[model samples]
Target chain A: MVDIPEHLLIKTAEARAKALGISVEQALAEMKGEAEPTTISKEPEVIDVKPIEVKEAPAPAAAVKADIPAEVDFAPETRVTQRLLTVVKAKPIQKPTSEPVDKVNTWPHLMLPEFISLMAMTAFLIFISAILQAPLLEEANPNITPNPAKAPWYFLGLQELLSYWDPQIAGVMIPLIIGVAAFMAIPYIDRNKDNKPSKRKYAIMLWTFFLAGAGTLSLIGILFRGPGWNWTYPWIDGVWFDDLLDWVHFE
Target chain B: MKNEKIKFRDRVKDISAGLGDSLKESSLWGSIFRPGSPFRKGYSDSPRNRSYVVMNNVLYHLHPVKVKRHAVRLSYTLCLGGLSFFTFIVLTITGIWLMFYFRPTEMAYVDIQSLQTSIAFGSLVRNMHRWAAHIMVIVVFLHMSRVFYHGAYKAPREFNWVIGVILLLLTLLLSFTGYLLPWDQLAIWAVTVGGNMASYTPVIGAQVKFALFAGLEATEATLLRFYVLHVLFLPFIIVIFMAIHFWRVRKDGGISGPL
Candidate 1:
């Protein structure tokens, strides 16, 4: 007989004892082959006779009078009970082996691309550094503020929004509510399991709208707005933004 | 014993070759370079050695011994996330160099002037730091969009996406705080515009503006506060989140999607 887990053995034994109207120890002993299974000896006190082989035939209700025992006993051989099943060889809880994916060593495969990219970035950064000097204007004087002062490029979108709407709506609420909170909650909000772009048209469209809006606003804020946050073409009015004073050349 | 008037050049060559071989064959050298490391003696181009190359090295261990072939394709990821991280490292190096000269005070402007004029390679380093900060912001945003489009943020990777957003916020914070370090008119006025927006925040508007400026308006104290946050606090917090993010990526079954 196969060895069962101790807890499972105990549980099975308890279940059998309850069904057979016997002690749990007796059931456990019988299950472990330490003793013969207990047989049911108590017969029904009185009942109308019926052939055992006629299990499928229904008896006439007018002639029947039920006389089953009050204790609710059943025989081990006749009643359903836990039986020893075949043992399975011990194996890993997870699939013992995995299907191999088309893969290559990280050393040269991943590392080389990573190295090339880092080098390219370094080269690009150095080239930009040499060409366009970082604009460092005169010392910070709170007394004389630059005309149409602007936030960093990234915040130019919000700055542009501040021009159209109240600062409460554009500057504070939108950025906090939509920019941070909504952005962080995207994975949770977008319940679509399918990752293919064709299947997720709505998400793509929504994101595209955001991109277009942000890009237009920032571009307008950067080049189209001049003194007093009023609209002015960059070509007409000298570039008002001082951060990119070096990048914008007008000879 | 066989040397019958060996030439001086040949003798030198023989001794050096022996020294090089002995060094590589030594136990100390073997211990320094682990098995499968190219630096070690008897290193060979073998599949097991390739696995060991990544598994043994601390830096290389960030990646698995082998990755899905699709992962290495530059077009797939555009390398935005890695570039974001690289830009951060570049910023950190340049920022540290700048720290030796810069001080967040009334004299900050003067310090910057001298840093550009007097210090060796100061202007170049400062320029790199400034540009890298801009690059980091752009790249980080791009990384997010890439993740979104690829649907790399689905199921097991959802929380990583959230952490990424947090990282993005931290990156912006880092850039914003660093913006004021030069104490130039551009820096001050730009920050003032940003600060003014914060003042528009409801309920605790004045309080938020006050805390940000260290007073009713931007002052030397505000510069110092931004300096500390830009240099120390924000980086520290971001690093912790980054560790968790990277760890969760591996735990979430490495990169998601062949689609």
Candidate 2:
């Protein structure tokens, strides 16, 4: 037979304590008391009867056939049993079980109509495109200059900027520098770990100011500035609206 | 027999305990496959958690979950701001299609005439390409403005902002090059004035002009060079920067947050 090591015995005691949903320290203390009966008798006032019953019950069953003297151990068991009987008699009785009933469904499932409408609108657009036969333009005319050799409408804003400063600086360099500076500083400027938009005040203010300035400048340039370096005063050349009206009349 | 049964029972218990320990040691389920299992519960499961499952998921990694949603919506004006990019695509396709029927020599003027009259929808294609190029420039500017307004140019994203600025320049370069391809008198004078501006760039102005015109004046070589730059070089460069711009957004915790 293999001898159980001291460490294994401790581990087994701990495992048993955990299985019974009790603390290992409590189990160990009770086991120590069992090893020395005189120690328990000397401090009988301090001894916990509940833990003693739990620990002693499992041990006596294992020790009964091992020829341990019954006189020393029978006293504690008898005292524990008498206390448990009195406690059980003092408790109120629990009621017996009743019959089971079937569960009734209270909630109904809901269907979404918004999703159906979206699908219908998408199908309608597709159908309309198929029915209308719009012709693509003629071959590319590299030679024939259209009457108004206009830059795309969006560039009209930047082209307007070109009217105020050098093309290299105003149209290109300033924009480039600003873009670079802004991109690099984003992480550092908004370092707060907050994800909510309302929490980030400075970042919002910065964006708003940037948008207003760029939009206003670009819009003003597009509306007021004409082609090339011709910075004719509105009083001399007439307002842009008058010029547009005159052009319309000529056409 | 009783001794043998006791020995077998002990061996089984030991083996079961050893297996349980090995399972815990190897982290068979937690480490091998279960995502973010070892970490604290809510911390790993939060949608904004960048380090956990996002590090492993192939597609989710492409986009940051906790983006400055307001910034992106306002920045590019949602993908309708992508209309400019779409217009660029349109121009490229139409430009290449036009090249099939048109030539770059002094004969380019007559070739353009033949293309309009002979080729089906040829004039329409040219008009669309021209209009689209104009639209693209406008859209790109708007897109840039959107980016700026959102403060997307600040830190970490600064390089992408620079890339965007370069892309804006490339857009203008594309426009300038395409301007000369028409081979008209207007194209001639415009290019001449533009080329002269290149010559006014202080030192090496003449050299820059020479490089741009490919000679003393805007000739066949100039047209070819402009065509290549407009269609080939600029597009290639812009695409590279555009990819970097998008990837950086994912890296920099998605668009700048609201102030």
Candidate 3:
């Protein structure tokens, strides 16, 4: 209703905007009655114009609902673009899937470990040879048999068995049966398809029994049996046991 | 002048290149050898090239193109089979060296004595051979136990288990025969006890003993028999079965892992 000069009108608008401490856009919006005038908060209002694209997280469904128009006219292009956005927002972002599950390369993986292990074993054997000396006794005299003249350490188990049972059974038949039943015929006898030891308890127990039995027999024959194949605790006699102590002797 | 410098560099390059090219082009070598092994140009970390590397080499062909990660684990296998093979290799080398100075006569004892006392590094080699043999026996038995405990003897691996048992028997026989080669009193009596076990067979008891001893007792003939068996016959048998054993390991789906 009142006419004001252009310069004065512009100055008044500027003064009002300064007094309100609002942006020109907010001031203009308030003048046009599009927005309500309010007191200024302690912190200045900040607005981001561009949408932030998050690579990891999918847009929440609620955010999508706020963005999309509540009702849409049947305009093909608008509907199609909205549908594409919805589709794009639906998928949760994922990191790229890593290496395939089966069929790994063996050149470096398998052979490298084998090479390292072999070298280590070779070094061990060389080191052992450096420290230990081979045993060679007096020439083979037909008459003088050493007391406790025993078989090789491996056959010691059989000899120990010979002490308990008939030589035929101990040396020949039992070994033969064991070789056939345990080693050769194991798969046939243990028809269980499971590879887990817990599942094949009986088979594992039988195997453990035989292994413990053989190991015990060999240890007994090698150490416990002394002169004339008689049982003597070499530790008590203090000859070979003394030698063992000397071998392990620390300064 | 620059041309001459470039020419010299080219010549050096050509010479190095020719070394490999000549090897590749030569009929005998070329036919036996294949290119693109692990370090070669075509080699890569891809599954195809890895498989080619295995399938292309004779020695490596014993392994499968691909193996389960668990199969090759140290905790699982403890590498007892590989250690047994390694010990066998050591024994063969030392055994051959010992054979050069050894004679299968009454002089056998003297030769062994000299081997321990006089020969260059003879005692060291002999000690290694002896220890390796002993270790091999224990390792093999442990390997058998490992196989059993792992349930590796199931189904497709049954025949390999049988071969393993035969190898075990051969290993013991080999040690027993070599035990007598020392010709000491210990050797004589131990072998006598071992040989006497053969006489316990029900039907062919005496014949078996006679066959082993070549007479009523272990004589010079028996010495020669064991020598021949130890050095030649048993070794040959072991090599044959060992190749089969290794081959079967791959064919039966590498070493067994979890079910």
Evaluated with TM-score, which candidate comes out highest?
A: 1
Q: What tens digits encode model 2's per-residue C-alpha lDDT throughout B107-162?
A: 77777777767998776677667656655676687787666555556666767766
Q: Could you give candidate 1's per-residue lDDT for residues A1-251 as a string of tens digits?
A: 67789999999999999999999999999998899989888654443344244233266642442464446533222433344456788986788477778887776677778989999999999999888789899999899978889998899989999988998999899999999999989999999999999999999899889988999999999888989999998887777777788888742
* Residue B66 lDDT (model 2): 32
Off by over 4 Å in 3: A1-101, A238-251, B1-33, B38-49
Clashing residue pairs for model 1: none
Q: How accurate is candidate 1 locally (lDDT)?
A: 0.86
Off by over 4 Å in 2: A1-251, B1-76
RMSD vs true structure, all candidates? 17.8, 19.1, 20.5
What i-RMS does every model get? Answer: 2.9, 12.8, 3.3
lDDT digits (tens) for residues A177-223 of candidate 2:
56555544465656665544566677768767876776776555434
Worst ten-residue run, lDDT, model 1 chain B?
B8-17
Q: Which residue segments of model 1 deviate by more than 4 Å?
A: A1-100, B1-23, B26-28
> Which structure is stronger by TM-score: 2 or 3?
3
- Which window of 10 residues has the lowest lDDT sum in candidate 1 chain A? A73-82
